[model samples]
Target: MPSIIKCLSYTLPSNVYTNEDYYSNFPDVKSVNMEKIGVKQRHVITQGQTASDLAQLAAEKLFLEHSIDRNMIDFLIVSILEHDYYTPSTACVLHGKLGLQKKCGALDFDLGCSAYVYGLGLADGVMKSMGAKNVLLLTTSVLTKTFHPKDRNSHFVFGDAGTATLLTLSEKENLGPFVFGTDGSGFEKIIIRDGGTRNPLDKNSENELKDEFGNITSNANFAMDGIGVFNFSLKTVPTMIEELLTKASLTQNDIDLFVFHQPNKFLNETLRKKMNIPEPKFVHCLENTGNTVAGTIPIALYESIANGRLKPGMTVVLAGFGVGLSWAATIARF
Candidate 1:
């Protein structure tokens, strides 16, 4: 049995923030052309909202649009950079909120930009191993909440959103042959320093400090080595794509559309041009969504299908590289 993507749906927070808004909030922040980054505006969750809330909204939309029965879904997999709580998995919480049957399996995985691709692989493996028929894969992030309001390096780079994808067992193999890579040495390239058990919060963790860029943040806030991440992506992503193409026995031209994680306009364009992927064949959806971490790829896929860039029988390549120094690429036929 092969995993087939049945449908994709996404939800964005109601609050809108833009580069101009950042400038207004932090006048000392270095000025950068928003066009170059490919983000004019980003949606952010307002107070009282959580990633699970966004995930639930997206899942509800999927259920309504596809008329899917909650009982029929055998597994629920959630990929998120942050969860609402520390104990129970977000997937289990979602399972109860959605009124899924007690027989359903649920779990959560911590991942960043590469989450959607990884979730697809996990779903395929679980379904194949357990003979499960249906799986709901949800990817989401509320990374903005972890960034200091004055942290220019990260505050302007992330947005809040969630995506829900349905994968069902089919005779035809529409997904697989994935290539994955990890470089834990670059783990510090993007990270939150004081939240996990490794570094529990303390007085110093909440104390604000200034970075070289004049961005102020606490040890508890999200911090990113922008230059380091840029270099890592340039070095690893293209090679991963090539390896994936080789694994799938396909070439650049064979893929009808290339959907890479929407980290930023510059990095994405750079990778596309390096791979010699023509403009029409590349899909970029970060203009209004910003970098929604794990949500970027699926949201882009949803928009691609809605706009007719993706269709049944069309082959698409999905790649994601980011936090954890992790990256993955895979081929799927719609």
Candidate 2:
């Protein structure tokens, strides 16, 4: 049996950060090139909300909005950059809260921007694991929390959102021929210096450090090497797309829609130009959502469907890159 994505739903935090909000928040940073950044506004979580909170709410929306039957779900998978606890995975936590069947298998993995496509890969494995009929894949992250409060360069580029994807097992395959790549050397390109076991947090981590660009960060805050990341994407993504197309034994023209992860406007546009992809065939709906990290591609898919860009009998190419210095692409028939 092959795993097929059945449906998708996404939920954004109520709070929003507009271009005006960015200017007002940082008086010294007078202006932003709205055309270049391509983010008019971004939804963000306020208060002490965790990624797991958004995960549960998104699952609720998936069930209520899609009229899904809880008992029908045979397996559950969640991919989050953060966890509700260091021990029990968020998948088990969500399974209990959503009141799934006792026998339903559940697990969670730590992944960032490439999570959605990677989760689908995991779903394919699990579907074959036990002849599972239905699998729930949730990608959630409060990535905005990772940014330094005063880091003007990268703060506005990320937004908080959680998305749920439902996959059903079928005899015919709609998803396959995936190409995955990783370069661990670029790990620090997008990193939180301390928190994990490799470099545990301490009181010193609380002490704020200012950079040459007047940006503020700490061992506990997120910092990205913008230039390094841009060059890495430029070098990696186009090649990954080619590898995926070759693996599927198809060319770019055969693809009906090209949906890649939206990290920011400049990088996405640059990559599109490099790949020579036409504007009409490529999907770019991130003006309102910003970079939702793992949630980016799925949210784009939902909006694309709502606007009639994606329909039955369409072949869509899904690609995701970033945060593990990882990239992956696959072909899926809708």
Q: Give a tens-digit lDDT track for model 2, residues 1-334.
A: 8978889999999998898888888777756454487888889888899999899899989999999998999899999888888878888998999999998999998778888889899898888777788999998989888777778876668788999999997678899878888999889998998988899999898688887766788889998777788899899999999999988889999999999999887888898898999998898878998888899999999998999999988899999988879988888888
Candidate 1 residue pairs in backbone clash: 313-334
Q: What is the lDDT of candidate 2?
A: 0.88
Each candidate: what lDDT?
0.89, 0.88
Once fitted onto the true fold, the runs of candidate 2 whose alpha carbons sit more than 4 angstroms away are 30-34
Worst 10 residues of 1 by lDDT: 26-35
Per-residue CA lDDT of model 1 for 215-308, tens digit only, reads: 6888899888888899899999999999999988888889999999999989999988888999999998998889999999999999999998
Clashing pairs in 2: none
